[model samples]
Target: MVSFQQESDGDPASKPWYELGSAKHQGTEVTMARILQEQYPSHSLVLAHDVLYTTYTRFSILSMPGVEVELVSKPDLVVNNSFKALPRSAFVGTPGGDNVSAELVPSVEYGGFKLTWKDRHFLLYIVHFARGLSTNTQFFLLHDGPEEPSHQLLLAAGSYQNELHDEIWQFVDGFWQKSSGLWKDIQSANWDDIILESDFKAAVKKDVYGFFESRDMYKRFKIPWRRGIIMHGPPGNGKTISVKAIMKDCSVMGYTPLYVKTFKNFRGDEYAIQAIFDKARDTAPSVIVLEDLDSHITEQNRSYFLNQIDGIGGNNGILVLGTTNHFERLDPALSTRPSRFDRKFLFDDPDRPSRRLYVKYWQDQLAGSEDISFPEALAEEIADSTGKFSFAYLKEVFVSSLVSLLKEREEGHDVSFARCVREEIATLRKQLDKPQGPEVARNSQLAMVH
Candidate 1:
């Protein structure tokens, strides 16, 4: 394979290719940038920047605003312009470096399309707008070198399939609706320092007050009376539990809880979400729970999601309670919106007060037994033991430890709180030794202490 790039010595703009009628393209290289700018106006195009001198000449013509065409290929063949007009040698130092077993192969077809390969051939895809446009383009080289590209092809196909699914979603983002049946009677309480953290309790009070007060002020302006709260944390740290507790608190303060998910179990059935939001708007005093928010709406769906949230035909009286493990990955525009999430709370593991409360709660649940009694020092130990254990893990710790103790007792051995604590510590010690799995360790620690 030989490659050639036309270059003028004096000026680039004076080149023959730059002339409107001099160098004409035989077939349209698909004006993707123009298509994206005209069609998907919301997204911007990002070009792949891996191609070199020879490759740039062909793709550069297609580059435009909000559109970037990049050639994802290897630089295996070093062109020596000796005899051939397109002076590039393919056989002798092929793109196949020491990392790959396959040799470099080059071919030309499809209106001057060149295929240069090291591990496998990477066909150039002209990307118009870069907002998660899925295509049947395979990514061969993952960790520097490449092996067989069968897996890469599979991944590309899967990605394209997902892209097709996303295209269907753009249509559904226009309207606003919600279901009234989504509301559930939540049980909330003014828990002691043990059951609830100070910051959490403080946020609850602030949001509850803000909701009513803000409504009175916004009524004059005709803006819907609504607010949003974003709760983010590691998994099993009791995000769901905190939501349940928060909903209960909201109900006690004379508010209803409306729960919503982005998608239903069945495909293309998002009417439930719309219906729920509609009810929340009509219900006046309602708190909406949108669990796993990141999963439901991501950066890819930002424009559509924003349309539903604050775009035309939006909802009011809806306090969106969203939970996510990865808050940083959320769309920047969504986070920046004051109307979207006015209050953002991050749920870390239970501190000393929370740990003590969990222990007390578990002890009360197992109160009939004379063998286990809650100790103050044991509370501190459990608190220390649960470095990042969530309330969910704390409950599991109690259950696992109690079950282990009951088994030992049935086997004719005396089991006490001391034994349970020891068993819990031993479990943590074992987890600390493992090479992977922190969630498992955290859960183990929670079971041991709580």
Candidate 2:
């Protein structure tokens, strides 16, 4: 059995030597494997290493059933020469709520721990080395048993991570990470709450639902079972909410939603695009939401993005739903191409009736509030006064009005909520009359060019 010794002395000569610095020059796995073999001569070593952000192997092992992990108190060998710990933050209550708490994850940077699984002893070392600008984490397992058990342990840990529940896979920083808060945010996004024209709403639903349900239909027609839909218009006109509703619906239909926040990462946009679609293909029959599609698909990565959309690797059962506020900025290959983004839905500024419906939706929300008297008729008045306003601007008006009303109450002065809302609307309307910014000017130029 491997016996424990005193912790590493300050002297570099006395301390154990590891090829950590040379990891950048050589294969990290090979270096770690060599170190493990030298340190644990009696036992066989199994090594698993990946970029720190890509996997949850440690957490998966911790949460595994009948598995116990104990940190090695006294280690004869300490590679990287220092002990480190960092806190893992978590929301205590509701996600995005005020309550946040963090727990110290011991020895995450570099430490040794013993894992007990199935009444067998296995020594494990969790170490991280800086690889260029990123950190590469290595998991070294030493056991006397046949390699199959250790291999099974690693495989089970990975499989546990792939089985996600109440989580949405998000592509950020060139990796696909899981975000439960995003899933929670979309839970309340139902189709009934979305205020679009009846026919328009139905069409959007059919576009998404029909594609997922008609996999066999696509096969019958001898076409690829992949689809792309673009939602484009001015900012904050039901585009985001509609996408969320679709995400929720897709989850209900047993399809995963993979949200891509941006394509800009350390490796470059090309790498990000490849990683995003790779995950989408792996989790086939999934929804890939490219929010702000115009910003993500630029001249640099346009061809790569198009190829991935209708690429040789056959994106079967994958649906790409892209949203953009600046439709004019999108390339013709993306906006007009047939198989790339097959359909484009314009979420233009709400018409008079749609605006009225939105106001009524807000009115109903405030009906039970004693402080805000948002009567049914007030909805019509506000909608009539707010012309050429996006849903976002209207929301700001309502929010600012309510805040002002609260301030008035706090100051021992009473004011009518209706008057406050009307004043705020007038204020926003004046702001809207101001000249457009340079970005808008550029978009207009591009629109003319297109």
Candidate 3:
């Protein structure tokens, strides 16, 4: 609603049209003024909230490309130019009155961004200063009642001249620039990347080649090409190491591996969570690694998660992969469909062949120049003797042996292979026999295996 008050100069009822008090409205009167402006063809200017005056003037000039912005801070200043002409004394300050209250027109106040325009149809680019996700620029069409205007009208809006702060704009702009760059980084990442351990090299070649063949067949048959894999095992197994090695191998083939630790709060915030899916959609052919899956996204949360994933709508290009120590804890609904996690493989504790290879792997990594070389025969013996030792424990054994060998060499004595092997074996034996209580041991032995 627009409220109009009558005003008169001392000259009778108003001498002439130029000297008469023109139609004036308050800050909240713009929407109504816009409506009136659309109906009438004679109104030259439509005034809005005083906060938008500066923005309107600046934007109106810049959006035209070849126009210049002229500031008339005081209300009585006249403006004239070759390209655009605004009244030099157009901007009006309060006409003070003895009976009028002091609160009427002292100053302008604003909380959000302010903008303005010259013509009935003018563009506004507002920069709302904020604290969070840093949305710097906004382009909006502030039309007069969403229709064609019957006349031209000057629409002025902006904050007070002295209150124009550049620091806030700079902060918003800086954050916007940095935040936008993450999209470019995400776009540059590759999907289809997998890494395999040196021992699994042959199996990986056959597995991946066959994996691609199945994928091709799915596409040929117009099937949803999604695959899930379950890599489950005891703690300290090669599950993590195998994933890392696979990442390294996949990097060679231009796969960009993104590791997501699926804890309680995987998504940062609502916007950030949406952004992850947005980036996924934008940057397809990528691998998303959900690590440590059991702690979060299980049971009840899993259903909620499936709902969210379905809502994402365009996720076919992403290759979903995951790792977990407790596979049974995962929701059965995840693997209910055959192709969901089509390739489930166990990364059990090292068997004999794996143990022998792991021993060589670590020995080659830590052995000194004059140190006793890795004994394949000894490794075979250790592999045969230590049935419960995992690859991680073997790596620890190799490190301990190297330290022992270095100490013996410092003592100026020939290191004995038997002594080193004995020390490593003793450590392994202790780890193997470290007692859980009788009850816990019994439960561990009978724990359900999935």
lDDT of 1 at 363: 65
Off by over 4 Å in 1: 1-194, 220-224, 249-254, 264-276, 363-368, 428-450
Who wins the lDDT comparison? 2
Runs off by more than 4 Å, candidate 3: 1-129, 132-216, 249-252, 263-275, 308-312, 362-368, 411-414, 434-450
- What TM-score does structure 2 among the candidates reach? 0.81
TM-score for candidate 1, please give it.
0.49
Give candidate 2 regions above 4 Å deviation. 1-42, 51-60, 63-65, 74-107, 131-134, 370-372, 434-450
Give the C-alpha lDDT of model 3: 0.44
Predicted candidate 2 versus true structure: per-residue lDDT over 341-414, tens digit per residue: 88888887676777888888888888799878887788888877777788888889889998999999899997
Displacement of the residue 140 alpha carbon in candidate 1, Å = 64
Against the true structure, what is every candidate's RMSD?
A: 19.8, 6.5, 17.5
Backbone clashes for every candidate come to 12, 0, 21
- Over 1-450, each residue of candidate 1 has an lDDT whose tens digit, in order, gives 223232234222222212322344431223332432343243333333222211112222222222223332222211223232322332344365533323433322111112233333322332211112321211112211232342443344334432211111111232222222222323322344235555665665576557765776778888777777777766766567667666656655666665564544332334545555565666556776778887777444456556666725656566777888887777766555677777676665666566776777766776787777766677677766775566666766777787888888889987786678667756754654533224332331222100
Better of 1 and 3 by TM-score: 3
Output the lDDT of residue 407, model 1: 87
Q: Candidate 2: give its CA RMSD in angstroms.
A: 6.5
Clashing pairs in 2: none
Weakest 10 consecutive residues of candidate 3 by summed lDDT: 167-176
lDDT of 2: 0.77
lDDT, model 1: 0.50
Q: What is the TM-score of candidate 3?
A: 0.50
